[model samples]
Target chain A: MSILKVNNLSVSFKQYTSGLRQTTHQVISNLNIELVSGEILAVVGASGSGKSLLAHAILGILPLNAETSGQITYDGEVLTSKRQEQLRGKEIALVPQSVSYLNPLMRVGSQVRSSVRKRNAKQAQEEVFQRYHLKKEVGNMYPFQLSGGMARRVLVSTAMVSGASVIIADEPTPGLDKVVIEEALNNFREFADQGCAVMLISHDIESALKIADKVAVFYEGTVLEVAPVEDFEGKGDRLRHPYTQALWRALPQNDFTWIEGSI
Target chain B: MRWQLTWNIVTFLFWKAIKMASLLVAISFISFLLVKNSPIDPIQAYVGADMLNVSQEQREKIEEYWGLNQPVMEQFMSWSSAVLSGDLGTSMIFRLPVSEVIGERFLNSIALMSVAWVLSGVIGFSIGILAAMNTGTWIDRMIKWYCYTLASTPTFWMGLLLLIVFAVWLNWFPVGMGVPAGVLAEDVTIMDRIKHLILPALTLSIIGVANVALHTRQKLIEVLSSDYVVFARARGEKGFTLFWRHGLRNIALPAITLQFAAFSELFGGAVLAEQVFSYPGLGQATVEAGLRGDIPLLLGLVLFSAIFVFVGNVIADLIYRVVDPRTREGKSYAVKQ
Candidate 1:
């Protein structure tokens, strides 16, 4: 079933001018996408490519100056600006970059427990806690006590605790070492295996192609192209669009670039 | 576990404060010596013009009576020794013990100041939090305007304005004085004294409330922008829980620090407010003693104000340690933890 779908999503921020003038900067323009249950859709783009902005718009956590106009249907219910946050914890969960969500003052275990209570479920709370290998007393340890890798694990664990059908993670592992990235990618795979719709937003094409069932490329505030992971198999030159071809050639395995001028 | 941590923090803070107090003592000694080295002589003010024309024998007798015949170093030592021994010396003008004079007025000021602080801290912080939560809205704009206006005006001027509006224009409260003369009479009721305290307390509190709100609003803005607040919202915290429980707790450290500074300044500001309202508080006592050049009283008031500031900072530091465990753990607390 289609758990989440975005149709014609566009977001703009109001720009103020001195001397009674004003304008609007359209940050995300005409973004359309869909996610089915138990599928991983990867959003690939470079920095400033509006990937995070799109995720924020979908999460309904955009700034006050941001104006969003689009139709989003999650589980057949229309998504509106007013109800975006309502969908966030229950219908959708967002794992922001950096384990910043884990408040430094609060313990990792308590943070996860809070997420569980917010979901109003007590059954799987312990199960989830144990599955993450979090010490039973870990709730007593504050976020500052956790290592960077441990903090990220706790964040992912908390996001899944609420049983939100869809998870949108932005730049899950941007600058981590290879081992940490592998761990992060494995975490996303586990979430997807739970029959949850997962959207992995990243700039690394190679990382996205690793686990994504469907891959979408974002550029200049729009989804440029999307295809199955199968399409990336030894078909770099056969890609239809110039941007997609550039992206394929830029992958680590395809360092042999026939086209210059940078993807 | 949190209790144990807090207990450790409190003990550690107590030792830190003791160390800080020792430093304050050194600072006080140096300042006393520096002041003594200056041109002003308390003796010159005490000796009458007739004494200069009198015999040196009689002058010497007078000097001995006042303990002025001793060396300057001995005099300062005597003063510090007296202070440490719980004797602030006699008031040169009042012909009364300095401690007695201060004790007479200290309770009144403490009472009035406490009332003013509570009013300001609660009301101001609430307004600030609400305004910040609704920033860009009309309520936020209104609070901004009010806070700016109140914070910019001096407390004395604000007190005067209140006196005019409530006493002269509306005739709702008494003018210039704290309690009525009858209230000081032995037979007067306690309720009457409270009634008289209202105007002075409000006068002192108006500016305090404004300042608190301004500080709280600024700090709340900083806190709300932090990532933790976003995380809380994503955790489905909406409405009152979001603003009060989540947002307020995170922003509390800065707001509390602001409140402590505000509390420290309350004594100094209350002097003017108390004087304007003719309230029999420390400021009024200090002013009366100052006009008469009562050295003991002046020094006592200065010391009291300094002590209040010192205590305020100590409380702020203790609270900071409680609010931020990382602060207790030091600069590398995050890494260490």
Candidate 2:
């Protein structure tokens, strides 16, 4: 059963194109995806392909310029903006893309502790930190004090301590080393194993494939195919959509080139 | 770790003190040069129309008394030595010790400036927050227009306008002077002083409000749109809770820096406003000393103002570190039990 479902969502806005002239810039259109219980759905797309917009849209944190139309049902009910606010950081949590998402002025411990909605916040944060191999003293440090890898772990810990039913990790592995990347991927897998729905948005399809149960190939602001992870192996011929097949063939370990095919 | 944080603050303060002391020495020397080079004759200005009647013998005696007969360097040395020895010399115009005059007038200036300073910072900060939170709205535009217009207006002109309207036309407050006429210092009540101070202080604060409000609005807009703030909002924080938790401290650091940097502007405005309203503060004394060639009084005022502005900035920097945990380089603001 789907714990979170986004059906036919479209996001567009009007902006001034020239002197007193306006144009509608549709960044995402007719997008649909779902997060089911105890599974990792990796949504892969190129940069500027509305990957992050989908995440923002579902969280109801889109910019004011954006106008979104769609039905987003969470936990068997339509998720309104008001309901999103109540569930945010409690029933549903987001692991943002950049370390900049951490408040520079706040302590790492306090930041994660604030996310713990139901439990002794300090103990929950400490347990998560220990699981990630972060030092006890790291809790007192600011975001800037942490290395690239520690910062990412701290971000994940913030979500883990929340114990949310659905966790959305957005572009979490960019600029990270292989070791740290594997650790972060493993952390997301653990979250899904604990019965939470996890949506991992990333442009690095290769990394996403390592832990993802289902791979959703997004192109032209819409999902071209949602196939099981095994379908991506052995030349990608079993993939239903031509774009997904091309994307798989174009991977560095594969063809490294995207061939034009039937739409 | 606690010990280290405390030690760091002490070291910071010590260095600031050393810097301020050296700056004071430089300021005093330069102001001395500027004062000595002035073409105005101290004796002539001091005697007024009686200069022609005074014989050469009387003139020599007067010059000798004030050490004007000595060489420039020698005069400076005498003044500097006296200052180093805790004496600010005597005011030639007022016939009292310079320190005594400064102390009495500084009390009055402090009252006016403190009222103006607090008023401007609190009111301007509130207005700035309102404007930033309501960006692209009429309230934002109105605040921007008001700040821009007031920033370009002269302090004295604003003083005069308020004088004409509130004090003259509306008869809301006293038109001028620091107190009621013929009232002894002992007889003047706090209410009387407040009534007289209202107009001049308002003039100074109104001018100050423009710079602070505009700066705060710009800074807060950037802060509100920052990534962390967006993330915090996505974390179910909004309205005053979001602003209080995330926005306040970030803008406050910059606001404080701007507020302290405005001390010189505040003092400068007070000088002009004092002349307009006949307020018997240090600002009024400043102009009189400069125009009358009172070296003791003029140098004294310059030194006092330099220290005043410097101390304000030092306090501002200290407060910034206290308010902003990032400045301490990962030293946690709170200790876990």
Instruction: Choose the strongest candidate by DockQ.
Output: 2
What TM-scores do the predictions have?
A: 0.90, 0.93
CAPRI class assigned to model 2: medium
Candidate with maximal lDDT: 2
lDDT (Cα, tens digit) per residue for candidate 2, span B1-337 = 6677688899999999999999989999999988788897888977888888999999999999988989998988988999999899788899999999999999998999999999999989989989999998999999999999999999999999999999989999998999999989899999999999999999999999988898889988988888888788767778897888778867887888889878898899999998899999999999989888887898999999999999888888887766666776552422321
Mind giving the per-residue lDDT tens digits that candidate 1 earns over A4-98? 89999999989887876889888888898999888999999888878988877777777777898878888888887567777777768878788
Q: Runs in model 2 with CA error above 4 Å?
A: A17-19, A257-263, B60-70, B330-337
Give the per-residue lDDT digits (tens) of candidate 1, residues B259-332.
78666679878898888989888899888766655677777777777777777877887787667756654334
Score each candidate by Cα lDDT. Answer: 0.77, 0.89
Clashing pairs in 1: none
Clashes per candidate, residues 3 or more apart or on different chains: 0, 0
